[model samples]
Target: MIVNLSKVISELESGSRPKGGVKDGVGSIASLGAEHLESNGGFNFKKVKYVPDEFFRSQSKGIIRSNDILIVKDGATTAKVSFVDDNFPFKEASINEHLFRIKVNTELAIPKFVFWYLFSNYGKDQVLSDFRGATVGGISRAFVDKTQIPLYSLNEQKRMVKLLDRADAFRQKRKQAIDLLDEYLKSVFLEMFGNISFNPHGFNIGKIADLVSEVKYGTSAPAIEKGKYPYLRMNNITYSGEMDISNLKYIDLAEKDEGKYLAREGDLLFNRTNSKELVGKTAVYNFTIPMAIAGYLIRVRTNEKALPEYISGYLNSLHGKQTLMAMCKSIIGMANINAKELQSIKILMPPVNLQEEYSKKIKKVHNLKQKMLNQSEELDNQFQALMQKLFS
Candidate 1:
């Protein structure tokens, strides 16, 4: 049977916060906003905010409980959902204005099952189909009143949830393994060179301009879906100093512009403009193929004095991020660090040979990580196929 979400859901409403907004460490009560909801159907409290105990006591709605479904109701992350599991860190929590807390009738459906269903492509499509507003996209209560879900017996739902959970666990493990590899690299960097900010190794300090042969911005040409060469944008550079070419665009450049815009292997790409937190993401281009970079990115070619890998590692370090964050000029919500400013940032001048050794080790780790990523992708495909089979 097919049933509307409104039929099985007992509570489907959003919450609000006080006039001045939530404060950190103000109380034990967690006030979760859309940022706390992860795209992978989980919660992240790394930057969680808190509301006062007295304010929480006064609220009759938005109190979070285990098995409740929370959805981002507006903004860029609208329609994103997360399940509040039994192990949720906070004993008392509530949603903010930008989130909707949903409670399903346990007599008719399992909350986990419904969460899984909504997390699937089938459910996301239905929810996004009703998305409204141009500047700030959002979905209305009508989505819950009209969207239909496949109704299964409680026992059947339990069985499906168990299977999905097992498959998801494998995916999560793969992701964790990848994250561990990154952490291991960070540890190795610290062990070899020490913290760049503190300069514990007492290496000579110099500006990035001294170590780089060239520093130039990318082209301003618009990119299309199909063009002569792959186009790299700010989003292509991961915060961890890795390239994510999964979603790429293409651009055709004139012969004159190719020499200026095309990135060579070993070049360091820096995202010069983005939100303050992500304004300086740097990655070393390891691809052999020709690719054009967008205007928001700056390309840096290292001289014999420095290695691209070493520079990339330094820029991705905690201290490097802090430096960029401090130097960047914020206009509205976006921050920018021009090529001149980036080239002027001071860096520790480690010996070239030591950087080479670090580069070699990083390469070995990257190769291993690539294989694991391939496996993870295959597992994701399998999980999605299963979701389609079961939910569709």
Candidate 2:
């Protein structure tokens, strides 16, 4: 049966149970300073404060406790929510003006169950829809407290919590498996191609321009109606050089234009523009799609002399990133390393046979990545189903 949060608050206050403050506790998110808290994925505590005191001078920063629900109320991250773990560092840490910390008397509503409710489609819609702002959006405390919450008996709450706990466990294991895959790849690369500084016999260090044909960016395509032309952006590149297709968009390109932007099999895609840390990230375009790269990406194709896989593995390596960073020149808060700059960068040359051997190992790792990714997707689907069952 459907339930209203306001009614629950009222009922709790009338008899054996009593509800706390209902008034919105925070102000516009613009008030918070750059300092903020960080949440650890697999840790004893859920939140760690990075926000400074200067940021909270005027706002009535709300307290967070174990099982307290935290909803991000502003900016692009709106509606993102986290539950305060029992071991969270700050039981009384004041949430910044941009976040709303919510709690109900434990007698009336189980906090974890409430967390599951807020995590569901109904909860997400309520939180995100409450956001009000033109440029940088925000959600009000009043909106959160008044948002309806489903009520279940204490026993039912316990059951749902147990189910969710198990589901989350599976999710974390899959994530760890992905992380292990990355670590294994790095180990493989190091074993095959010794660290740049370490040359047992003798090694050749040369400028990168000597190894490859050219580095070039894809031309911009005018936005197209939803269709099949695969359009990829820099954000799609993962740390392990995999493409995330969840938010993948397509551009309708004329046949003539297709040749210019379409990504070829084995073509290496590098992020040419983004925040300092994000720029220089790369992924190999493994899928054979009539795809066009976005303006922010650069495609590096090799000549007969240099193998594409050789450069791809090198670029994804630590040494490749350091070289790219050295060539980066910042402009107006954004850093860019042009094709010329990238080409001029230096790398240690491994023999063609050795390069091909490393490439085979990398391909094996990529295959493992695809398998783990498929498993992750399956776990995600199961979790989503559980969420719907717990809420509905």
- Clash pairs, candidate 2, are 35-51, 36-51
Task: In angstroms, give how far residue 202 of model 1 lies from its true place.
Answer: 3.6
Best by lDDT: 1
Q: Each prediction's TM-score against the native?
A: 0.92, 0.81
Candidate 2 residue-wise lDDT, 1-392, digit = tens: 56665444321110010123112333222221112422212222312333333433433435344666666677776766676677665423455556666676677777777777777667778767677888997776556455777677888889888988888887878878888888787777777766677755355876668876657787676656685677888778875567787777777777877767778887878888876656787777788755788888888876665567666666777877776667677788788877777677666677878878877887888788888888888887788788887686
Give the per-residue lDDT digits (tens) of candidate 1, residues 163-273. Answer: 999989989999899999999988888888888667898999999999999988999989887899999999999988999999899999989899899998999999999
Q: What overall lDDT, based on C-alpha atoms, would model 2 receive against the true structure?
A: 0.66
- Number of clashing pairs per prediction, in order: 0, 2
**Where in model 2 is the C-alpha error above 4 Å?**
6-49, 53-64, 87-95, 133-135, 199-201, 226-228, 252-258, 322-327
Per-candidate Cα lDDT values, in order, are 0.91, 0.66
Poorly placed runs, candidate 1 (over 4 Å): 20-28, 52-55, 224-226
* Candidate 1, run of 10 with poorest lDDT: 19-28
